[model samples]
Target: MENTEFRVELVRLVDESYPVVVGRDLEGSVAEFLADKHPDRRAAVITDSNVASLAAEGLLSSFGSRPADLVVFPAGEASKTREVKERVEDELIARGFGRDTVIVALGGGVVTDLAGFVAATFTRGVPYVSLTTTLLGAADAAIGGKTAVDTPAATNLIGAFHQPAAVFIDLDRWLTLSDRQIREGLGETVKHACIADAVFFEALEDAFVERGLSPAEFVRDDALAELTARRNCEIKRDFVTSDVHEGNRRMGLNLGHTIGRALETAAGYTLNHGECVAIGLALQSRLGERLGYCSPSDVARIEALLRAIGLPTKIPEEVPVDRIMEAMAHDKKGKAGAIRFVFQDGVGRLVVHDGGSYARPVAAEDVHAFLQSQV
Candidate 1:
């Protein structure tokens, strides 16, 4: 059978343009692409424990020659740390791998982020490619070159901006994901639509809200998968092309990520990243309503779509509101010593603050009050 593919060219803020390829059963195509692109560079596969078996073989095959090594770490958000990063670097060094190695992140978001950071500092910088395995990675994590590890303080407080030479989001790899995982990815999907493409937002409403289908019911729906993969990369491309380092307009991509990261970090990652963002998407839309940037119905529609897709639209009781606030204080998005957030202007567009930044600073006390009310 012939393979169908969706390609988005990402012209990053630095260096040459990179291609993001989205397709199902893409191992063969990926091999040819990577071999052509980096023929002389040695290859290294950096992944996690759970994804090592699933990712190594195909990725090693992409190099045309045997890879230098497979660097696997523990497979969860917890492993997204400086320590794990050090270990990965140490292994690569001990194996004689160096600056000429093109790191292949062959797992989910964690691998992409951690390995990209490793690439950023390894011999001052080396190139990497993303073989993103999970739907969440395909939706939000794999693109944009925003790679980082978490500290006790905040999510992504310690990281770097290092673009990959290319990205491959293989839909076939995501078939192993559970239903909740699919919903988590959809949360980001809905977020991308909410911020840039009103038509995409309406398409999501039609599929998940009006039709009322579980994300799993359409798990094998290739057309929907292709649409989602392409749109995710394309929407992100708009931001990275302009602000690769996230200096200005790129903050628009954080519409649901502000409160989402704080809560997830505070919750000690007990919550899935996508689910927390779903809650944040709902909360921020409501905050937008409070500021008159959007209508109440707009907020309701956002929450309804999230709920219809089986994502959590409310904060869990166990995660303290105060802790979430504390984490937000440490967020990388802070400006003027105030916590700024990216809020939506109705369903499909983001609000640009009067201060010239795409995000605005709402009083911390106000955010606390609103969060307390949600409990």
Candidate 2:
């Protein structure tokens, strides 16, 4: 038998921060954590239809109590809404669950977000654990503890900051994801390296672009997957812990999200989050070129890596440029009449303005022109 446990990372906050165990074959360790930490608490596992039959089933069986499972909401970004959340909460109530329940979020980012939200409010706050099975969740979403569901007006409009008791990045399950899923998750992986960890960024380029290894191949290599996932969490933790609740400090983490999220909304969610972020990253690099934040070579290198990883570096023709512009104005980070973009200085570097803000206000007209030029 292989002993699979490895290093653990901590978020470290003002009040309390929890440990994130990063490794492969984490099912046994996850079960042990809940058993020792929660004792008699019932785990009301939450996941979506896509994941209910996957890791969720095994995770539930691992529970010492063999605790009852949870409802399988329809999967996809569409399910990340208030209506689905209301129904999940209702189902838990009907099952007689209470404050003693422990939320086991056993899927990708969607499950992590929706389930964590349920924990934040159910009985006014119950402990939760994230067995993040997807590469996206493992690299980014599952670590932050920011929980929310979307509304028609915008994404994640209603949410709370409820950190999990523990987080497990189960790399064993990540192997089950498709090649496209692997590429999508690398959007965050690349984003993590772009903002911090220059060495990690170069390594990604060398492996996926220069040497021509595919995203799927990279993730399948245990050594590569473990190091990449671990680095992503560390970069995220560095920013999140310093500004847990609200501070301009953590805004740097939004590197490509500002435009990426807007494009996602404009595209009507047809494009997955990671795909949209890849485009946003390319666009930001272009903007950097125009603004002298980065050179033409920098833009080329960034776009080449994104393309090599099987991600989109250009805005799709089907997604109207004007709609993307409109969505930006409504971005949650937008101030007054301007959108503050987290621009890049170059590959592996983000721009921080003289005012000490990671994102700076860009003229909407300039952004409009940039969109026009791209199309």
Residue-level lDDT for 355 in candidate 1: 74
The per-model lDDT (C-alpha) reads 0.85, 0.85
Q: What total of clashing residue pairs does each candidate reach?
A: 0, 0
Instruction: Supply candidate 2's per-residue lDDT for 110.
Output: 88
- Tell me which residue pairs clash in candidate 2: none
RMSD of each: 9.0, 9.0
Report the C-alpha lDDT of model 1 over 206-291, residue by residue, as the tens digit: 88889887766655788888888889889989987898766889888888889999989888888888998999999998888988
Worst 10 residues of 2 by lDDT: 60-69
